[model samples]
Target: MNSSLQLAVPATRNRAPVGPPFRRQARSRLLRADLLTVIAWASVSFAVALWLADGGAAGFSTPAGSFTALGIVAGLIGMDLVLLMLLLVARTPLIDGAVGHDRALEFHRKLGKPSLYLLLAHGALVAIGYGIAEGLDPVGELVALWLLVPDMWLAIVSIGLFIAVVVTSVVTVRRRLPYEFWYVVHLLTYAAVLTAIPHQFSVGGLFAEGTWQRWYWLAICIATGAALAHYRVLEPLVATARHQLRVSRVVPEAPGVVSIELTGRHLDELAGSGGRFFIWRFLAPGMWWHPHPFSLSTEPVLFDSSGRGRLRITVRNLGHGSAQLTRLKPGTSVAIEGPYGLFSTAARSRDRVVMIGAGIGITPIRALLEGTPFEPGNATVLLRGHSEAELYLGDEVLELCRRRGATLFHLTGPRSAGEHSWLPEPAVHSGHRLASYAPDIADADVYICGPDAWARSVISAARAAGAREEQLHYERFDW
Candidate 1:
């Protein structure tokens, strides 16, 4: 195993000026987030308004009637939410550019349980309400609906599939399953949606033939599906053919850590700031079906005259899926899905920037240091690891810091025993903290990537040092 310490001396140059340009970009991102929030809530309101306009409130005069009316409302809203969740994860460029792929997925995860609950409640309440009207028990009514109502059986199966999807998605359950197993189960979500659609049109009176409400619901569902098809399927195929990325070589950086370099056509057009990740699929047998999200460890180098460029990503074997990547041969075709995440220059809100990373997470910081805008002395990079070798790409990061005039610190050693901290034991014992390394962290944009718990600790230290939430940018390594 490789274990050693390397650090770059801090540059004595003056800091860069903080100007209107960075602040303008930050404000624009903020606006986009706000707009997304408004649109989501407005959709729910619109769903409810459709029923209200159809005189849905009159049915609430009786207890059974009230239950049935509320059930209808719940189903409408729940279905709308399901569509919203699909759009959020559809890789829509507007949403990806606005909140980034990671944040959009975060919101998508948050909606999962709630949408499932709303759907369950809609089923139960509708059954109970109808049972009362028919002088039958809830269970009896459910059976009757499943057996006698056209398309209702499919709806019941849809609910069952949704339950399976959500249960498998629970953190504990998900941890027990292989990622491929979990992914296969997740695909049932589309089947569930399709199964549920028939009952929505056939049984729901609000969506009967010639109704405007039916048209609106159909449009939303079609749009969500189109977005998924276009962005997730078609766009990737087009990009794969257009770029023609092929693995040029794989160079080991450390034990189990390697950098995969690719040569592609018009690569500069796909280049974003460093630290942004792309979802890559190697079109080789056994691995062609699996996609890996890896950040570029170096900026794309383009030879303008030839429209040919090279890109590189440093990866460490962290799981079975990634371990297979180490064996990939030269000339392997690669399909890409993004330059996602906001952990790049686009997220910079200040003249000074501080990059913190641990273990394999140090790779993206290396890329950011090379490409993110910063005056030589205005950037500070802190890398942490249990051993120097664990700090993958440390030498390259150190070299970049030196050439770019940024300060670099390598914190390598065992963890602190007394407190929950990201610093090494020696540094922790000596009273070093995040603020100690980057004294102006309060005014700097702090970009952090690492293990979940360790990253949280660093985030806490940064917050304690007066960094606002908006000033902290993080890319989570865990899916």
Candidate 2:
């Protein structure tokens, strides 16, 4: 096993700012998808309601139809409630550290808009359906609506939550808020979710038919409540009490790269393999609110065999929090959390290994090759760069290959069709490389980590060559 490790010193550099939504994939297209999903959900819901109402005939019955409608509305209301709560819990900074801020943001995007639409549909349907049944004038119906059916209050709360999610999702507005402030506001989602549950129980449109419906609602209530407690209240508290991480040293690496070493009680608990990432929060001056994901560039061992473990994370200064990391000096306390993700040597264990890296994404692949135990001649490192100058850490990788007895292939120009094949670089003979190497791709496990475009290509190439989905592994860090 290798013992000593060294990381590059950090240096400052100009970085392009991250614009709204990160990359430009016109909002109009995304809105179109969202609208389609809304229409689908509403249609499915109405279909289910029509079936339950016995083809809309029973819908006219007061006590009977109202009870059935109550069950449908309440169940839908409960689901929306629970979803909103989970979103809020996920926004907490401590929890955010577990998955990283970028991933959490992505999750919000997937679930947020649809959730708002579902809630609105549920509310509008209930109001209109109930209004017609009561046979009252528009003004009187609006005034005495909640008086006759108090569950509308839950719909009111759901509306509040929808507004909150919309406001937070806006890029220009959210950027102005502090991380802690945003976290607090996000917690309101839990309250909204819980508040909606009672409405579900009281208005049993879906739940009135059988004991199973009540049981299902009860199950949802308990499961959602438990998850909220753990993610929001319990998980972070455990990190604080158990890990108690503090940054022991910060060394400047080459431009855009910084080495951060952390120490805490029971470092053995913190020991993890290479390529695994952690959500790090440096709370001290000069490091604040930059809770982003970083790859572990060093082995997970106590400072020494007899001491606590130390971790080295190489961060490429991409934006706000990342740029500030270059200014960190030793003894600047940090709350190191997470050992999340599964992009490691274990995923690469096979007769032959092929690794690819783009720009700073090479950090994790570097650790997997260097920190982990491996036999010689089993793995090959193929590194591609735009130019020799852009090669972030090629020397270290070559040295690692030399130590492990693996071959290193470097391509420092624009990639071509057959450049990756062992056949002559200018001409890629796809069959020759496969036959000479692992003829049966199903027997080989491929691990890839890097930029989105590069990772996708790797996956496509592997699959095209007949690699099983289970036999291929990858880590995607794209925002």
- The number of clashing residue pairs in each candidate reads 0, 15
- In candidate 2, what are the lDDT values of residues 368-459, reduced to their tens digit? 77754444544656555555544466677867776566556654554555434322233242333432343445555566777776677767
List the candidates' TM-scores in order: 0.95, 0.69
Every model: Cα RMSD to truth: 2.4, 11.4
In model 2, the runs with Cα more than 4 Å from the true position are 1-115, 136-151, 163-188, 203-215, 231-233, 286-289, 304-307, 345-351, 371-375, 414-442
State how far residue 17 of model 1 sits from its true place (Å). 9.8
Candidate 1 residue pairs that clash: none
lDDT of candidate 1 over 1-479, digit per residue (tens): 21224344455655444434677788898898899989998999998898787778887998888888888888888888888989988988788777888889889888899889989989999998899889999899999999999999998999999999989989899999999999999999999999999999889576876766888898998999999999999988988888999999999999898899999998877666599888999999999999898999888899785669999998899888899889989999999987778888888778889999998899889888887777766788888898876888877887888777778888888887544478887787677777878999999999999999999899989998999988998888777
